[model samples]
Target chain A: MNTFWIILTGALVAASCGFLGCFLILRRMAMLGDAISHSILPGIVIAFLLSGSRDILPMLIGAAVVGLLTVFIVQLLSQNGVKADAAIGVTFTALFSVGVVLVSLYTAQVDLDLDCVLYGEIAYVPWDTWQWGGIDMGPRAAWGIGGVFLLSLLLVGLFFKQFKLCSFDPALAAAIGIPVVFFHYLLMTLVSFTTVAAFESVGAILVVAMLVVPSATAYLLTEKLHVMLFISMGVGVLCSVFGYLLASWMDSSIAGSMTAVSGLLFLLAFLFSPRHGMVIRMLARRRMRLGTN
Target chain B: MNLLLALQDPNTQWVLMGCILLGTSSGILGCFAFLRGRSLVGDALAHAALPGVCMIFLLTGSKSIGLFLIGAGVAGLLASYSITAISRYSRIKEDTSLAIVLSVFFGIGIVLLTFIQHSASGNQSGLDKFLFGQAASLVKSDVVTIMIVASVLIGLTAILFKEFTLLSFDPGFGRGLGYPMGLLDGLLMLMLLMSVVIGLQAVGVVLVAAMLIAPAVTARYWTDKLSRMVVLSGVFGALSGVLGTLISTQQENLPTGPTIVLSATCFFVLSILFSPRRGVLARLFRFFKLRRKVLIEDVQQALYECLEEQAGSSRPGGVYLGIGSAELALKSGKSLSQVKSALAEMVRQKIVAERAKADGSSTWTFTPDGLKNSYLLVLNQRLWDLYHMNQNEYHHVHIDQSQEELAPQLTEEMLEKMLAQLEAYDLTPKLTEGTQAISRLYAREQGGLSL
Candidate 1:
């Protein structure tokens, strides 16, 4: 039962991140996603300081605000003639440094353990079960991630066409009177909410793994957007279950094992994907060379 | 006082020197990273180095800086390879590959670290500091390791400065020049990996990328020349390290890495705001200067038009008019105060003269030099309008800056060609028609974007 709860929580976080990660990778904003995860550190820490507890709601709100701010700062810097990558590098690193300073400064006053924030403890997650009128409701982390996953599903389902249009051709979407920037921020907000929801089970940095790895692997295996999304979500759930078992066997970090497994999954796709495998492509090129000779 | 006390301690002195050395090398190499559009690649490399450090510790059972650096370097190299391969061979973009490589490698490192922690040998190992460094714990041996690695990195950068410059700005050109481009690139990445590894004990994997980027970006706002930028970046990086060390030493529990990054960010903000050339204040100043020039030009064009309006029916302007502030204000579409300021400026430059009329009202008239200036200003405006008249829509013209001072000083042959061209458009000898052309151009400009 403990293992079930832990794996279920991991799967929920992974699926939501994987869902958002597809868009991020397709739009070539994967690193910006990484940047937001880092920059939200200050926001999360500030929320902890204000509430003086480990409550998840305020932290999610704080993370959403900070995530949007991260995008805003990066946009402002680029508009000021700073290069995109440099702007990303400067803003995220500085914000991350602020978070680090906050963690160090208010070490005793705040309940956020810096070590836990760096490398999360997924094994202990099941112990923090939610209670409603003395009924067992499972771990709060699982519920939080489950709620985020549902929200993402509803939002994506309602606005699938708009998201596809905006992602593929923002200028065209704007010409057609769709609020492209609004959609952009909406996607960013979803990513922020997802990051905060998964913050406890996956840690701050490893959340990027959940956001990028499965989607990138799916990107290799499939060409259709919806198909890629489904595949990545499946990969996310698969990795989470296997990752928990692997961690249990090794008695190691569950989040870390999950992330490592995601990478291995990507590697496998890189080599064996039916449509875009490296080995197959190399062989095709060699055959063409031989024919020419 | 705390700073002074820390400065006296030999241990602090060693750490300070170590940081300075680390800062200088990272800053210099960071200039290349900034130019290459690969600034965040360093962040990926820094995160990727963590597992290598843990792997080395597990294998050697010792925390030797040398072994850790080799391990980290290998890990970073592997990450770069995967990034290049993914972006080049597959449909994955460079940025996606960077993110994937970064998180995956960092995840592996974390897993290895967790395993190490739960193992028997983990009790004595202080390897957790690599995640977020504790710089105050640096001993003499660690500082020595940093200095050695930093010197090698700096020395290689200095020796291959031009090759690096070419590599950063234009890798294609470097390849064309047959400079062993691949080898040079590998060498630069190795240096970057070494710097991250060296600083792992002080700045940590999380914030090492900051040292590589902030100083270089701050320096970029100060200069355009690569050499000067490199020097300024090194100075800025060294200052951040020294100041961060001092401040953290004074404080109770602050880590040096984040504090150093904060100091570097302060420098970046300062440069962006106050640097002479590329700074925000400088840009604002230039914008205002351009605005003043535009206003003054408008007044000049208005004076020339006023003179033309008074000429006999169908006759050219051999006439002069002492226009009042109200008429000038109406003609230039400026406020009365704005018109007065422009007039005062023209008077100071002897471009216009103020006279008291018999009705006790002051009227402004263009002097001889002012007349010549106004005539040329009107001609240039007309020429621009006519130049784009052939196109379906008007386009904004950017005047050659080198010839800006020569606008009124066109030679005999050049003036003849210009006036002849204007004559062909039926715009010559009729001053009102030229003004009409300019108004039409301005109206088109104001309507909407051309495309």
Candidate 2:
């Protein structure tokens, strides 16, 4: 029963992150996604201070605001002649430093643990159950991450065509009167919400693994967008189950094990995927050489 | 007084010395990374060092800075290789590869770290400090290790400054020059990896990248030259280290790594907002100054065109007569207030004189020097346009508009040819007889002054 709740929480996180990761990698904004995850730490801490609890609402709003802010500032710096990578490095580190300072300063009053924030203990998820009207509702993380997963699925499904167009060619989208900037901020908002929701389950930094690795593997396997989305989410679920089992077996960090599993999956796809695998491509070239000879 | 007492403590001194050495090394090597547009490589390398540190501890059942450095160096090198390999062999973009390697390696590190914590000696190993460094824990031996590594880094950077510069700016050209560009690149990466590995003990894995990125970027805002940038970056980094260490020592719960990173960020913000050449304030100032110059030039050109039109209609008397501000505004297609302000500025410069009409409104006319200035301005405009039309090769060439004399820009033969071309097209600026009289008066005044 405990393993079920933990795996459920992990799957919800992987599903949401992997869904968004598809768009992020397609648009070449994967690092920006990583930056947003790290940079939102201050926002989460401030919200914790303001609410005096680990309530999800205030945390989500604060992190969403900061996440959009990260995107805005990165764009502003790059436009003003700062190199793109440096802009990302500067903005996120500065914000993350502030978060660390805040966390250390009020360590006593706040229940936020820096270690837990870095590498979350998903094992504890089954213990911290939420209650409603005197009845228990399993773990709070399952609900939170589940809500985010559904929100991403519904929104992404509704605007699938528009998002596809926007991701592939923003100029053509703009020419056809689609608000490119609007869709851009909308995507950023979803990414922020997903990141904050996944914070409890996968921690902050390792959530990037869930966000990028599965989608990147899916990207290698297919050229179709919908197929890529399905593959990524499927791989994300697989990582969750394997990661939970691996963590239990090794007695290690659950989020870390999940990400390590994703890494393994990506390695497999890199070498053996039928269409784009390096081994297959090499074989094809060698066969052509032999035939010509 | 409190600061004096704090600095007197040997513990504080060790921490300070260690931090300064760490900052200087990271800042110096960071310039090359920042210049090559590989700033995030530092972040990736920092995160990748964690599993290495954990692995060494697991294998040896003990911890040492030297062994950790070796472990971290190997891991960072492998991460870099994997990044390049993924991007090269697969269709994954470089950025996605960076994110992949960074997060996955960090995840693996976390796994190993947790496993270590569960071990018998895990609590005593003090490995969690590497996650968010505790610089207050530095001892004399740690400082010695940092000093030795820092000196080597500084010495190597100094010796290979020219080769590294070539590698950063143009590796292909360096290859053509018979330098082994590949070996040089690997050496620079090794230096970067060493700096990152050494810094992990003080600044931690999370914020060490900031030590590399912030000071170097701040230095970039202040200079265009690479040599000066490197020196300035090192100074900024060391200053931030001192500030971070001092402030952290004074407070109870303050951590040294974050405080240092924040100070470095403060320097970055200051440079972005206040640096002379590339700062936001300087760019804004130049933008407005250029706008004002363009405004004044447009008004002057419009007044000359109005005078030319009047001369073509009836007679040459309009040059001496003043035109109303409203009429001038209409001719210039500018607002009445804008035209009046421009005219007032011209009056202050003695380029134009204004007289109060019977209705108490101002009428403006150019003085002798003003007439000559406007004539040449109009003539240069027509001459350049005609030259551009005839000379397609020089279409994109920029002319120095600030020079008072055109002779420096165009040869005598070229000028005569351009004037002839302008005359053939009837595009030369026409001056009325009254304007010619004003020009002659200005010539005579100039001749008298020279005599």
Candidate 3:
């Protein structure tokens, strides 16, 4: 029963991250999410330093601020004539390195460690339960991730039209007076929030994999945005469950197991996704040759 | 200060040498990728190598550089293969396909790393440094290995340079010329994969992509010729490598990859601003010169018109000419001094004359030679317009015969009709004795009788 709750908690958190990740993938900001995952560390450390405690809200807010700052800094650098990829590399790596340094400096005083920031403790998530209204709620991670998921869902619902417009043709949206830059910043902030929430449960490195792989896999499978969203969410949830199972069976880290599962899913999509699969394409070529003959 | 001392130390020579070799080889091969618009493949392949490195470490239980590099190379090749396969099979964009492969592979690598960390292995903690690279730890053996690999890469690129250029510039034409484009493309990918894999140890996977792209992009700003661009890019790459290595070696905790990227960025900025011919400063200078010439021509033409008006109607006072009367100068919106300077330039060209004035604010008039010159300029402009029309309407115009040979076939009536169409745009054809004399001279020069 306890094991079931733990896996369920992971699946819900993973699903929430995947839901937002679908839009990010569609927008071609997969690497940006990876960058954000690395950049949020300093924020977490800063929050701990200021509050002298490991509270969720302050850390989440701190990480979110850093994530937003990362995007803005990347945008500023790119606008000042740095290439986009180069800007991303410069901003995130510098922030991550700073975070590493800070953690090292404050190791004895602070509750935070670099390992927890990097790989997270998904297995230990169920142990940290929060009591709300005198009822024993599940893991603190589940609440945090679930709250973020609801918020993201509401944001997506409210701004579906704007997101679609911006994603498909930002210039056209700008011409039509849709506040393209604002929407872009908003999207980045939302992605940052989700990344921070997901980081606590899935680990930072695996969060990047989760945010990118499922959505990318769904991209190969479908052309429609709504279909992609649903499919990516499904893929994310399944990978979490299957990964937890694999980890349990193999007696390995659940985060690693989940990432490996996601990678396997991505590989399958790359090699055998119906229209875009490699083997099907080879067969199609043989048929074309036969028809020509 | 400490960093500066470290940079000058003799012990850092091997690191510098390795960076130079890596830069030269990657830059040379990167031109092919840049030309093919596959520059981002470096990033994709770098990320893709993570899983291979981790898997090799897990399997071998050893950190032999040879085995690790082999694993990384295989992964890079696999990534290249998968990207090609994805692009061939679906309508997904090349970048998107690359993103997919990059994330998945990196994810797998992370998972494997986490497992390794969790297991009872002590060596796993330091492995993440490979993600960003640790240049300070580079040993003599590693430097030698990089040089050997770089030499092989450079040799391969040199041997296949011609075929690679042909395929890169125009694959369809290369195919028509009976060249094996498939083989060339495969060979190019192989070289790129090797460069990236070998670079992973020194620069690490994080900044290897920047090495490939930054030099190529910087080289593009310096030259239009492919050979020059390749050579310049190689130089830029080597400079970036040396500078980055030096900076990182000096700074205690500074990563080499980011420093290398920063150095390459400086090269890119310098080339954009200062390269000859195509640089920003050159283009801006040319624009200013052209503007000045256009202003002078406008002033001269305006003065010529004022003189023609005075000759026709005995209007010696000529309707009070001012800066507004100078059409080109007025249109350009130059200051009064600039307009005067342009008028003075026309006088120097002998296209206008200054009438003696009491206050030194002279009125301008055209000389007889100037009137004739203006008329010829107007006629040439008309002819240019007609030539453009002919170019658009008739794909080709053959003028093999002289005026006399064409005179009978092209009657005065036909010429009148053509001139009427031309005059609709406000051009008037004058019956000048000089024009007739020139036509006769042209006919004789063509060895045909005058009309």
Candidate 4:
């Protein structure tokens, strides 16, 4: 029962991140999510080092700050004539390295380590639960991730029209007096927050899987943004459930299990998705040829 | 200084040599990628190698770099193939496809790494670092492997350079020429994938992307000519590799991959600022020099005209021996004394002549040589204007033809006949005058010619 609840919580978290990630993926800012995931290491490290605790608020604030910084630095470098990809490479790697160095330097005195920051401890997560009024609330990760999901949902709901306009045609949006730069930053900031929040349960590395796979799978399945978001959220939840079960059965890491399941799902989608999948489309052609004959 | 002594060591020398070979070859292969405008595909492929590396380790229970690299190469190729397939078949953009492959593959890798760490296998501790890269662990055998792969990539690039260039610049033309565009494109992608895989051991996934793009971008600032750009990019890549390796060797824990990227970026920055002809500095310098020369020539021409105006009375001595000459020189930013000196020099040069002064000031007039020189300059300018007008007309015709919808039954022969007729009509003076007027109107604006 406990494990079921835990897995449910994981799926909910994954679904929320995936829902938000669809926009990022469609906008071709998937790598930006990856960059935010890696760059938040320093923020989390500093937060832990300063607070001497693994409280959700301080960690989220710290990671969000660093994540925002990553976006800003990448934008600044690109604005100053650095190519976008190169700027991303420079910003994320340097920040990640700095984070690693800080962790290594502080490990002697501080309780924090790079492993804890990178891979995270989803298994131990259930132990860190908070109580609400009269009920036994779930783990801190579930609540933290849930809060992020709500915030993202609110933002997305409020600016759904604006986001769609900007994502499809920023030039047109700018011409029509839409605040393109502000929206661009807002999207990036949301991505950063989602990444950090998801990092609590799934780890920094698997957060990329959550951000990319569901959206990519959705892309293969649909053309519309609304459809993509729904499909991505559905795929993420399924992967979370299947991955958790597989990890539990095989005594494997939940994060790895989730990623592998997602990868397998992508492969299936690539091979069987209607209109786009390779095998089905190829077979369809063969059938057409036979019919013509 | 002690680091200099370390360079004399055989181990250090070997590492340097290895980096040189790797860098040069990767740079050469990168030309195809740069020309294709898919320079960052190498980076995506590099990241894609991670999942493959992790999976191989999990399956084989071995940490052998050779096996690991082969796995990575396969994954890179798969990533490239997926990117191509996705972009071709779907409405998803190229960058999006790349990002999709990159994140999903790396995610799989991360998952695999976490699983491996949790597994009974005790050797999975440092597996995740392979995602970023650690070039210091390279051995002589690894260097040899890299060299072999690099050489193969370079040779393939060289062999297919002409075909690749054709396809890159104009795929339609390449197709018209009956070249196997698909085969050549695949070959180029294969070579690029191989280069990215090989670079993993030296720079790692995080920085290998820079290697593919930075050197090529740097070289672009140096030349418009393809051959020169390739060679220059190769040299820059090699220099960066050697320097990065050497720097990493000297400093403890300084990653080889990041160092190489930083060094490559330095080259890119320097080329942007200082490369000859096309560089920012050179362009700025040329602009200023041209402006100054134009100013100087305008002043001299104005002064010469004043002299000619005064000499119209046939009493050249009376015209030159007056205050008019001094006023012309003052208007042209020259002092009265300087104007006199200039007139004397011009007379010696046979561009102008000085006559006896009627009121203590000498008169001047333009010589036949000066008239001839001005006439030639005007003719040259006219010829240039005509050529550009004709070029613009040709471009407009080409664009119009491309945009026109024609029936499938309208064969190439028909198109050629139509073109011939158009050319014949274009030879008429009226048509020429029309084109000239359009070009003149276009030239009135201060913008580049739009394609």
Q: Where in model 3 is the C-alpha error above 4 Å? A: A1-156, A159-208, A220-223, A244-257, A267-293, B1-11, B176-178, B291-451
Docking class of 1: high
**TM-score of only chain B in every candidate structure:** 0.86, 0.90, 0.81, 0.71
Over 4 Å off in model 2, which ranges?
A285-293, B120-125, B314-320, B384-408, B411-427, B432-451
Models 1 onward score TM values of 0.91, 0.94, 0.73, 0.70
Per-residue CA lDDT of model 3 for B422-441, tens digit only, reads 77865553422266322321
Between which residue pairs do clashes occur in model 3?
A: none
Listed for every candidate in order, the interface RMSD values in angstroms are 0.8, 0.8, 3.9, 3.4
Which of the two candidates, 1 or 2, achieves a greater DockQ against the reference?
A: 2
CA shift of A141, model 3, Å: 8.1
RMSD values, in order shown? 6.3, 3.4, 8.5, 11.0
Candidate 3: true interface contacts recovered:
0.25
What DockQ does every candidate get? 0.83, 0.86, 0.25, 0.25
- What does the lDDT read for residue A61 in candidate 1? 88
**Candidate 4, residue B91: lDDT:** 57
Q: Of the candidates shown, which would achieve the greatest TM-score relative to the real structure?
A: 2
Question: Which residue pairs collide in model 1, if any?
Answer: none
Report every candidate's CA lDDT: 0.85, 0.87, 0.73, 0.71
Which candidate tops DockQ? 2
DockQ of 1: 0.83
Runs of candidate 4 with Cα error greater than 4 angstroms are A1-9, A31-121, A127-140, A200-205, A222-224, A271-293, B58-60, B122-129, B270-451
Over A160-205, each residue of candidate 3 has an lDDT whose tens digit, in order, gives 8888888888889999999988888887777777777777767676
> For candidate 3, what's the RMSD?
8.5
Order of all candidates by lDDT, from best down to worst?
2, 1, 3, 4
